[model samples]
Target: MFLEVKNIVKSFHNEAVVRDLNFSLDAHKTLSILGKSGCGKTTMLKIVAGLENADAGTISLGGKNIDNVKPGKRNVVYLYQEDLLFPHLNIFENIAFGLRIKKFPEKEIVEKVNAMVESLELNGQETKMPHQLSGGQRQRVSFGRAIITSPSLLLLDEPFGSLDAGTRQRMQEFFKSLTAKYQITSLFVTHDLKEAILMGDEIAFMQSGRLKVYKDKTDFINDPVTGVQNEIGFWENLIPGKVERETLRK
Candidate 1:
């Protein structure tokens, strides 16, 4: 296994957020954490990313206990719903920030940044500032910055949630291709179940700080008590063939 989150419990002001959770992931596999608003999904991701610690639990990456580790050395990169790129830095500089911080050679940093730009289709946008780019472009930069670090794991918190339907679908395809190409292990958090099915290899459903997994898409759709299936099924079931090609396009 590449990551293990064991019996995690987090609370604030005596209000439980993440209730006793246990899950693990394999190397190079993508996992999505799905739930409604304020289900402690984001908190769980933060715990694994080392940005927040669990009140009672353990997070191990590559067999190392990282509960007390600092966020920078945790070998995980996080991309938030909004573009969290450095506002003052240009695209090239923002993506190269990690390499520069690690003191990589100038030539290597250039090469790495260029490769990432090409991969992310940010070729000519390298010199643009954060305010100059569109929402989609800025999100791309956020993803590029995280990937450039070569982190052992990546966490995306509703990365495409801010984009419109069309742009969001486009990014979904691009991100899916990128992750599959790099074989990156990630724990993605989102409220969109359709996004989870299309972007993640597997998904864990969370309800009020609790997490559960289904055997497959079919099982997920048929869950009686929770109705935890992907939104596509829910939509299709409600309106047969109403799901047109355009509705699900990238």
Candidate 2:
């Protein structure tokens, strides 16, 4: 296991938000967590990233216990729903910020940043500010920035939730391609079941701070409580045709 979260527990006030959460993720794989709002999904991610303290349990990454590691030194990155690009920096500079902070040699930073921009298809827009790009484009920039650091783990919290349907779909496809290209180990939390299926190698449901990880896609799709099958059924009934059914399957 590349990342092991063992018996993690966190509470707010007097109520437990995450209860003995235990999960392991291999390197270069993705795990998607599905849950409704206030299910503590974000809190779990925050704890894993070392942003929030866990009252109990441990976080191990790369076989070492990182429970006491500082957030910056933990080799983890957290990205939120909004693309938090620096408004003052252009696309190139925004992506290069991490490397600059690390004081990488000038030539190396340029090479790496340019390669990442090219991979993300942002070559011609390197000089644009965050406000100049569309929502999807801004998010691509965000993804590039986080991935350029080559962190040990990436925590994404509903990163595509704010986009329109068409843009959201495109971002989902883009994320798939980026993950394939980078082979990043990511823990993604989203309420959208379709996005969960699209983004994760394995799906897990989070409710009331408890996590139930499905063994595979079949288990996820077949589970009644996940409501994935119900959502699919809704689409199937709404559009009655073999083509529509096949489209839904895809």
The C-alpha TM-scores of every prediction are 0.91, 0.95
Top-lDDT structure, candidate number? 2
lDDT of 2 at 212: 90
Clashing residue pairs in candidate 1 are none
Residue-level lDDT tens digits of model 1 in 72-186: 8898988889888899899999999999999999999999999999999988999989999988888888888888888899999999999999999999988888888778899
Candidate 1, residue 213: Cα displacement in angstroms equals 1.9
Best by TM-score: 2
lDDT score of residue 207 within candidate 2: 94
lDDT per residue as tens, model 2, 145-200: 99999999999999999999999999998998898889899999999988998899
- Evaluate model 2: give its lDDT: 0.92
Clashes of 1: 0
Cα lDDT for residue 244, model 2? 38
Model 2 — which ten-residue stretch has the worst lDDT?
Answer: 240-249
TM-score of 1: 0.91
